[model samples]
Target: MTRQLRTGFLLALQFFSVIPVKKQLPMEKEYITAMYAILPLLGLLFGSVLTSTVWLLRDTTEISSLLLGFIVVLIGLVLTGGLHMDGLADTGDAYFSYQDRDKRLAIMGDPRIGAFGAMALVVAIVGKIILVAESINEASLVWVLLIPVFSRIGLLALFSFTKSAKPDGVAAFFQKRVSHKKLQLVAIVALVISFMLLIWSATFLSAIVLIILLFGFSWLYRAWCLRNFSGVTGDLLGAYVEGVEILLWMSLLFFV
Candidate 1:
């Protein structure tokens, strides 16, 4: 059990970072569960950094809102190594490849960025910065951390429900091993914990809105994939996760 917990933690870290675990950690049913559990913990760490940065900037200089926003965004992208940025790029390439599903997926697999991909990356990053800068709320910044974590879980949901379109990739392994029951449990636990930890009001209104939006987006994406591709691929899953995160942030920013 101890070994499994360590392996799961490693897996979660690897999933979010460029660092690779050398050995094949034996997969247990709890591996995905652990990933879901550790997600908010990671979010908390990143949130702390951003929140600190924001407060420091607000205190340190009378920077214009536009400049401060840009700086905050720059710091965030640097911290994450622009992980979602890559996802946005890949997604744009795939979506605009002007080819068949296979060809589109192949485009996404390429390391090179196309014009469409570049535009998507610019829009997502800039849009996020603008929204965060304008809001200037500490709680809102903290909630932004959940964007990446929950979005990744949304990707994991796609993996659980669909098959890989190719023979090898990150999604391949997860798709092969992650089960429906495990994914469902992970989703339930993650959502519950998110609300429990994020509670700022007695009404729990914000949490309820977030829950509805997250599940609604997940189910809608699943249905769209079924109608179009018949199965989800690594690239498509990446796109879904990033897209969902962007929309989720937008919703939270405006609604909550």
Candidate 2:
């Protein structure tokens, strides 16, 4: 494939729910840079789809809030194909089992979900359902849009600061593919856009608080990883995404 076509393909694979581009693109710098660009765009795409779904359900029929929330969940699952869900499951299985660092890393790489993963998945989904039900608003939904984008942006911090505990897998691909300078640039852009979105949504203060909290959590995550596993993994990135999204909603719901 031409470089441009390959780059676009990589972005599509990394970012969008539509057009499932199956083959993994070459782990090039351009491909990795495209990932940061593509990642936030997925948030925008999902948010737009979500807003439309809510409007359609609200307008076309008398959908109950509970049912609507379920639909929203399904839409998210379909969009990302449960990518983050898998992350949550893996992280939970690894973290909560009280396994040693090497064992935890090994378990995280396992495809099978354990009892801890199952429970964590249930809790995370239920929490999302409740939050979506309560926070369903045109404005709030717009802020809800921030969850995926910022979560992926937050992934960059993990990639930037920590070593990959595993020598192989998705984490290795990203670490090899993306450079520090490119990751930093993408993060700055994502954060600036995030702040602007917050301002636009009239939640500027909440946005600031959220960023600080994200950094704080990132530090804690890093420390925990070092103490236990000695470095971060793909599952940890997934956990970070879900945890941060939950915290963001909880903060916005109660504090903002």
**lDDT (Cα, tens digit) per residue for candidate 2, span 99-206:** 888888889989999999999999998998777666564336557577767776777767777888888866766777666786678678888988788777766677
True-vs-predicted CA distance for residue 168, candidate 1, Å: 3.0
**Tens digits of per-residue lDDT for model 1, 1-256:** 6765677778766666444667666566667566544554555565577667777776677877667778867766665566767867987887777678778767878999999999998888788777666655534554655655566556656666676666676666665565567666666676666677557532377777777888899889877666555567655665675577667657755666
What is model 1's C-alpha RMSD? 3.2
| Winning candidate number (lDDT) | 2
Q: What TM-score should be assigned to candidate 1?
A: 0.80
Global CA lDDT computed for model 2: 0.74
- Model 2 residue runs over 4 Å out of place are 1-19, 22-24, 58-62
**If scored against the real structure, what TM-score would every candidate get?**
0.80, 0.87
**Root mean square deviation (Cα) for candidate 2:** 2.8
